[model samples]
Target chain A: MDLRAKLALLADAAKYDASCASSGTEKRDSRAGGLGSTEGMGICHAYAPDGRCVSLLKVLLTNSCIFDCAYCINRKSSDVRRARFTVEELVRLTLAFYRRNYIEGLFLSSGIIRSSDYTMEQLIRVARTLREEHGFLGYIHLKTIPDAAPELLAEAGRWADRLSINIELPQVRSLKELAPEKDLAGIHGAMGNLSGHIAEAKEARRTPTRAAPPRFAPAGQSTQMIVGADDSDDRHILGTSDALYKKFGLKRVYYSGFSPIPDASAKLPPAPPPLLREHRLYQADWLLRFYGFETQEILAGGEGGMLDLELDPKLAWALKHRALFPLDLNRASREALLRIPGLGARNVDRILAARRYSSVRLADLARLRVPLKKVSPFILAPDHRPARGQLDSAGLRRQLLAPSAFAQAAKPRQLALDV
Target chain B: MYSVTLESPADFAGWREAARGLLGAGIPPEAVSWHSPAEPAGLFAGPPPPDVPAQSAIPPVPRDFLEMAERAARHSDPERFALLYGLLWDARRAPGLLRTPTEPRMARLEAMARAVKRDAHKMHAFLRFREIDTPEGPRSVAWFEPEHHIVEAEAGFFQRRFAALRWSILTPRRCAHWDGAEIRFAEGARRADAPADDAAEDLWRTYFASIFNPARLKPDAMRAEMPKKYWKNLPEARIIPALMQGASGRVRAMLGQEPASQPQPPGPRRRRKD
Candidate 1:
């Protein structure tokens, strides 16, 4: 098949992975001896119809697979047309795209073909050739085969800026039932080894006495968990993510809702992917990482372990814990200010600085571009105070709720990682 | 009242020198009018700004205020210089005036600086380079229209990033170029000067189409980031309307297709002891 046809099929297969980030890596440019540059902030060269940023040239080496995971489009039983790109073709394509500023770099993943080690070797070779031969100084993210040998995994890390291994399913029992071939223990074991190497490499680079240590995925590792493919609740999914972040120090845990595939398995659920559920999960994830909210606290904001579709996780939490509302804008600690619904970290810092000079008032909040309507009932400024028991008013929730399009529960057209 | 005429639209140096001189001469911000060449000249404009002494004493302001002033100077607002000078004059008496956004002068300056920063960031994200072959080697050229006078200020970013590549960025206001060694500036040129198409764009369009999941179309969100003004220059943007038009039918087709189970190859199940 032609390259275009192969790209169409392969990129279609790869779209389900849902991670296109090219950020937070060591800064490097092409002036020295390479063909590209990455200066911290990832650039989205274009936006897809799905509203997701197109940062990298994400594709698979091939869509043909040996393992028949039920939710996957490229499962061995799925009768989709398959194609593979020659290693040289992929490298040439990446360079061509990079030269025209179409992408930051390449994000390459592959379905298991022949064996785990062989598939991994092919993936590593593409990255190695890009770095060694062409002197490409761009971001590369390789999907590591969880069952591959440790030495091969190490080599994969050395070549790429970021490495990932998808958890696939949130629960181990779900994995056992649907993807019989996947071993959760094996996946965790590989992640444990990667975490050790990544940590050690970082320490070695920091030590002044140590010679320049080799880089090992400076952007760190992230994973994707397929949501709505099985009987997994938001609580269960977040619990899994929490454990992964603690155990492996994951940079990100992407939640890809299971969109309907053309040739889906008979046993798989015939439901559309829960796009809003995925979005709510992301909001909760941000709260977990940035807002210092624990998993239990976030889940408490939801009903029956499902997030409120109408309200964001932060606002929902504030509504559920009404006693925590009406925080003093002038005297509240930075942590307390962060819990306010309309206050982001940036705005909170501004409030902290502004309050240092003088007591902040409602007019000051307006000038700072804080969402006055959403925050008024929750905060007490110098010149403004909420009415008695305003937080406890029955109509407060109605007033706080914004008009959300996803509240109507439309079946999303496709699964994307925008959230 | 003193009148100051700046050399260019984004003349931070000229603005800074004039501000320092006016402050040293004890001229209040309300007693001055600032003009740039890009703006219309007043009928009875005052003479050029008076020079400051070589060892003139300029009062120290907060570091953050200086940074904000530097960015706000690049704004298209003709009054940005006067605003910063006014704030500087007021800040001498009210030492902490810059810290609070409650002050209207400080708030307006902050807003203008944020606008300029966003414009620079958009330039970084939306610049699309098309390949153009030259006698020296392959060069890349892009055409961009910025909302602020940021072309000269943002040139260092491209220089440090794409240092090895020979490229030129053309805008209606000004243009910048890098010849693999040093950076240069040239007069602005028309869009017709740029090559209309590149051979690689077809494959890029294919990738864009294939990667997009038709089931989840959010054209508004896409427009919010990429914006309609930038669509004309983007190669893949030509297909966006058609893609949106056909998204629903495509999703329906995928949903209606019957499950086609292929024969399973020899896989991991047999090897695993489950």
Candidate 2:
């Protein structure tokens, strides 16, 4: 097949790699008059599991790798069809697709070949040519080789908007087991280098000087951790993410559940990790990062090593601590409102805003756009009051467990209709 | 990063002159960029503000701000040049120079007004309305919300969408209505008894449930992205309950079904067995 045909095959294949965000990067446009501009937010197209890469031209430098990671489809031992793009050919294709408005920018990843250093250099050259030669300011997220030289990694930061070095697995043992050829020390070194560079650049920008700061990676760096490939549970995964963020100063820690590769190694499992487990990890991760919940606090509630499969992490947390419910909606803090399972951040804002004009009751909540049914039981509102003292601790847990608890306990046949 | 500050001017003659002065004083022009209170409205900006008082009327003086895209070009990065040059530039401001208004200040004034009015704060301050059901009998109600009184802005959006419905949006600020008549604003938040929109609400609930992606539940992430402030006026805000599928077994099962509207959760765990 010609380049287009090869791109169709390879680009589509590459979409399986989630983590296609193009935010946090500077803008770039094609002087060649390519259709879209990256100087704006690069097209942040997410590949939603059933296989669609609709937004970006997510492609690989080459699918040919010299290392064999048991979980990776592109590992040297795998039998998948492979294609490689020359630096020039990749640029031409990017321009062609861009002119047609087919994509926003390039999300380029490659399997290591020739050598880690050689592969890293080739990737750097592609980004440099796109940026300097063409002034192509679209979002360029280059997958920096953790094993690449520090100078090359710094150069990668200069041209690309965001750089990601996949941690691959959570545990050091797993990294040694699944992909022994991959060096954990090398990975840590690259992450440290990026953190230093981004911090230095940002600090320079802060000085009250008229001169611009040296451009490093302005958008910052993030890393990915493959969930479920190892024996680690949700608690373990969340703990891992927290440590990485604290230590490496990452922008994000993407969780890519270990999807079942076509030809698996003897060391690999036959099935994909439970999709819901990955979903739960993301929730737990969010709660830890944004909700002010510590990792151990959330971990304490999970009876199984995993998060609650039926309910959200927050709700499950609430159910465990039923005494905290029946909070006063009229005077609850934003932090307190956030604790309620159904009352998201938005609901809290509405409640606070409306209460300023009127003493909020259950009815007022409905008016302010707060989900009273979800929040009402947990909170005491004016119009529709909660039967706070009536319920025993166990019953309260059941109520926090599900919004339809009373009706469900009263009538189990209504499950389909109730939902 | 001083993000979201609107920049005015595009290296106008005055800006170039300022650059020369700064350069003479040893400051590299590339060290820092300036952003004034310009409207985010692009080259094809919208119609000028119809309201706001005369303070903005004389129209802003025209020379645009200069952009600094490089830092290395400066000697010692910025220190060697800035210490001497920064002082000279600061002292160099012309005391009596009001200068002639070039392009017209109407655009800048309008831009600042719109920024304040449409900003997230205004969204919280404004927005008044009553609930109404849809033709399909779902309870959905809308209110008249504004950055300022743009009858056309609110009316244009509602006429086609809620033409046949009865909804009242009352603002401590301004009022809007579709009393089954021409879309127009009244004086304040309408009476609560303007007739309920039960069907619209039901439809909204269904629409909310239908469109909500189960795989997209990140309370902290969602909260950070769509701050807790603006939920007061939006019908979809109530749907946040429905967004938390894991909290309910039935909802969790529903999410597992991979509703055609969204995708099947493909996180490593959900991949199908061959």
Q: Residue A114: error of model 2 in Å?
A: 1.5
How high is the lDDT of residue B65 in model 2?
Answer: 17
Give the CA lDDT, 0 to 100, for residue A282 in model 2: 62
Model 1 iRMS: 11.4
lDDT of 1 at B152: 91
Please, what's the RMSD in Å of model 2?
A: 19.6
**TM-scores, all models, native as reference:** 0.94, 0.59
* Candidate 2 chain A lDDT trough over 10 residues, lowest sum: A410-419
Q: What is the lDDT of candidate 2?
A: 0.55
DockQ, structure candidate 1: 0.33
Grade the docking of candidate 1: acceptable
Model 2, span A3-25: residue lDDT tens: 65556445644644556565655
Score each candidate by Cα lDDT: 0.83, 0.55
Assign candidate 2 its CAPRI class.
incorrect
The reply for model 2, stretches above 4 Å from the true place, is: A27-53, A367-369, A388-419, B1-274
Q: Candidate 1, A5: how far from true, in Å?
A: 1.3
